[model samples]
Target: MTQADDLADEERRLRQLRLVVDITAQILAEDRHLTLCEALRLIEAARTTAGRLFPGRQDTFDLVVRPRLERIVLERFGIVSTAPVN
Candidate 1:
């Protein structure tokens, strides 16, 4: 991919992460804490395209949504990126 393509891809990833941050924040706003089951439930409740197809499968939640939510939570609390710099 060209430099522009890379930049665009990064931008898209950041946007998606931001959306995850926002939605996860809203869903977890009530107690500011959640049990593992609670977190899974929240992800299952999402109305995204994948959610509609896959429903509440724990495997889907773990493989996809959970990591994004974890990253956003970490990012919000001033933990520097664990992702290695390119």
Candidate 2:
């Protein structure tokens, strides 16, 4: 890829990462009843579902957002995963 292509890819990934963080934050904020751990789990579940159903940049925001936030708890929050990362 050309330098411009590489930069574009980086920018796209960064944008998606921001969207993922934003969605996770919103999820954490809106559901006050759930504990932090529970909310994190919810995000995980959403990620899994998105991976299976959407897989990647399909079109809709739901498809794009979910996988970007995927597995963030394990990577970001250091959650002990019962299963290995695939």
RMSD of each: 9.8, 8.3
Q: What is the C-alpha lDDT profile of model 2 across 4-69, one tens digit per residue? A: 998887787666656665877566555547565786576665565444444564344455554445
Alpha carbon deviation, residue 30, candidate 1 (Å) = 3.8
| lDDT score at residue 8, model 2, on the 0-100 scale | 89
Q: How close is candidate 1 to the true structure, as a TM-score?
A: 0.40
**Once model 1 is optimally superposed onto the true structure by TM-score, how far is the C-alpha of residue 72 displaced, in angstroms?**
12
Cα lDDT of candidate 2 equals 0.59
lDDT of each: 0.58, 0.59
lDDT of 1 by residue, 16-79 (tens): 6557646765665444556656755655555353443435555665676666665654544445
Candidate 2, position 6, lDDT = 88
TM-score, each model?
A: 0.40, 0.44
What local lDDT does model 1 show for residue 11? 83
